[model samples]
Target: MRTSLSVHDLSFTWPDGSTVVTGLDLAIGPGRHGLVGLNGSGKSTLLKLVAGQLTPTTGTVTTAGTLAYLPQDPGSDPRRTIAEVLAIADTLAALSRMEAGDVRESDYDVIGDDWDIAERTAAELGRLGLGHLELDRTVATLSGGELVLLSLAALLLRRPAVLLLDEPTNNLDGEARARLIEAVAGWRGTLLVVSHDRALLNAMDDIAELRGGEVRWYGGGFDAYEAQVAAEQEAAERAVRAAETDVKAQKRDLVESQAKLASHARQGRARAARGDLPRILVGGRKRAAQVTAGRVTGVHQERLAGAASRLDEAEAAVRDDREIRVDLPDTAVPPRREVLLLEGVRPAFGDLELDLDVRGPERIGLTGRNGAGKTSLLRTITGELAPAGGRIEMKVPWRYLPQAMDLLVPELTVAENIARIAPDASETERRSRLARFLFRGRDADQPASTLSGGERLRATLASLLLAEPAPQLLLLDEPTNNLDLPSIRHLVEALRSYEGAFIVVSHDERFLDDLELTRRIQV
Candidate 1:
């Protein structure tokens, strides 16, 4: 296969002297590849480097042909029209002047052989399920899903040899995401996508994982990559077991050797004390016994040291993160408890209404397309957003976690934020609980504004889960929106151990499945 892009010894460092990517080497041929990694693992940064949006601190990037990049959040002037966003405004203006019979020679130069730009733009939009979008429409009037489709339409108009997309489906609804997946399925050029959207990644021709500052390629799509990693982890676990066994055997032998040496020394001393040999011979025997004991102990000690080294080598293969362990509180609810009641409730944002009763530890997934009343419903329940009409009765302590995770006071430290919710908790108790959430020492003291996407969510979770009364009913809205795959996994891991019932709003099918939802509700 011909390589379409290549990176040699690439490295990047932030202006604050923090290193993100270091000495990375990778190559990609003409095929679709999904790039995945943890939240701060530099997937977007690497895409920017390849697209020439950012200069690498070291190493070289080579591209065979024209490249176009779509950022996670495509920015543009709100007043710009669709034609201008597609870079065809000038050509259309010249075409109009030519048709009006007042065209200069420069107008013809601008139009050239690309006079069919208008039809091409319409056709691209139609193919992407956006035929209703007019070329003269301003960007500010579009929805989040529409904006994403508009960006894709712009990229398709250019027809670049290589296309790079970062989180293209972030805010896309079900239909919009499906449209994008269809477009991607028909793509023939070199494409690299970085996303946490599993359904999108599973459509790739191959997969590349950026872990521990390296890219590892796997054949086929997301499912294949998952199986391969599982195998690797299994092998790593087996190696750890064998190494532990060897270390134990070595320790046993060392103990036995020491015991034998002590017993032999006592026997030699008793034999000498009976006056069975002359004084000089007795002294010589004692010296010989000491030398033998040293040699025997040294040999066993060396074997034990070698075993310990082997154990360390074996343990290095595993990728376990014990510090981020999720410890569930003992707050499980009984099956007969009436947790919530929402009767004739109409939330602020959508046209839908709900009359429902939730009981016990139910895992409810509130699913719908973008612009739905999912968030509004959660807010109304929390009394943050009042209902247009109707009533909501909650019999349990409930907390709502919005997508932004702004529950904490940004100016305060994480520990201080926890203290706000759990005023009765001792300072040492707060620190101990925060440590389990991976905030130790100075990390707990770091201001909330400085926290990353994953850390902020963890902090929010800590605040709600460790509240004074201990929330029995939790409501989460798009909790996995900006999180990376590892962060998603961590969230799932934490939720697995949670005894409290929750209602989560999400469009991610894979994530919803992993949560083991007891029921799904449509708004």
Candidate 2:
């Protein structure tokens, strides 16, 4: 197939005064393309530009055929069922053919009737793992992950020439994400995908990195790009060191030359006073030497300036444009035994039981089909929900980190929020604690709402830990959803080191496996 989508010098700025994407040029053909960058780098914005959901302020985006976008958050589209939603594309096509009367009698024999099309559409839904899903189930009732998968199925039904996906793996489990990726990889059409999953990027033909309102294309895998970035950083560090050394050497030479010039002037004055025979000649020589010394000083200054320029470039290169530092406050708590216990706890909501028994030191993974009450069960354990019939006992102080980072006040600055959370601590003490969590100086003044998803998570965790009574039990729901790989690793390390019990719900298999889960509770 030929290239289906092309974007040239595309730029967009929101009315609220943020240039999300600028001077971006991209050419997409038939192979899978990966869009990898830090959050708010405009990956989603670029996709929106291509899909025509957002207009560009400059340049143009052109598509040869039909286009579709599967948004990261497939907002509530409630009138369709899982199966009906997937079949909409086929239904639309069939209706068009009937209204146009373009299907001749002979064409009907070859193309099959409306019933045949509907039957095959239903079959296709089954292949995509929605076979059991009722054709009449409302989209509103599905979980966030289920909605994402269903949206993909709907996109496939349309059979567009180009597909733009924004974090399609957002709410999906390991298996679902893998299946969705495999299906897209096998697709014959063009694909542009935005994802933070490093493993997924390895399967792409090329990657595009967005930073500072610019997009850089790398014609290699994730590993190659990472290696290149690392080397650049090392080179930058060396340049900085060399610049510092040159500055010091230049300053020392300047000091020595000034001293000699001063001594020479003093000697000339002595010779004049003595009225020595060759005083004039000595003056001429001194004048010539002074000119030469001045030229040498200028040369040294120029060389120092050159060194500074190189150092600047090196600093830019070593900045590691995509790096994000997430720090959580250090919390000290007394050792505890049996943080939480659930004995044959059959928590039910509307006659449907969600979870069974759960114990401490046991890593319980909640997994099931959507609407199987995974989240409901977690809420019950965290006291967010009142269980109808189950018994839950808690022995230690606990803290809950919701999936949405809802605990953070959106309007408050990072430092102010921290101070508010720990009201007993002084400003200096609060700032010191926040500094350990990497919210230093001006950074602490940025409102929590403006923070990146990872940053918000870090700030939230830091505030929770800095409370008067640190939590001994940490309950996290979908902890790794929007976090980058490095942030996720840091969080895992922090949790591992804490002398506290943890219960987390996530769909990432590799994450779960890497953390060495003790046991899995299928809800």
Q: Which candidate is the best by lDDT?
A: 1
| Candidate 2 wrongly placed segments (more than 4 Å) | 1-3, 8-19, 52-59, 77-80, 87-120, 234-283, 321-330, 347-373, 407-452, 459-463, 466-470, 493-499, 513-523
The runs of at least 3 residues in candidate 1 whose Cα sits more than 4 Å from the true structure, single-residue gaps closed, are 12-18, 48-62, 75-81, 84-87, 104-114, 138-141, 322-362, 371-399, 404-427, 441-453, 463-473, 484-486, 496-501, 516-519
| Highest-scoring model, TM-score | 1
lDDT of 1: 0.84
**How many residue pairs clash (N, CA or C atoms closer than 3 angstroms) in each of the candidate models, in the order given?**
0, 0
Relative to the unseen true structure, what is the C-alpha lDDT of residue 41 in candidate 1, on a scale of 0 to 100?
70
Clashes of 2: 0
lDDT of each residue in 66-184, candidate 1, tens digit only: 99999877878889998888889999999998889986999888888778999998888988788887889998767555777788889988888899999888767678789898899
Worst 10 residues of 1 by lDDT: 321-330
lDDT by residue (tens digit), candidate 2, 95-169 = 557668876555444345444556666666665666667766888677777777777877876678988988778
Shift of residue 487 alpha carbon in model 2, Å: 2.9
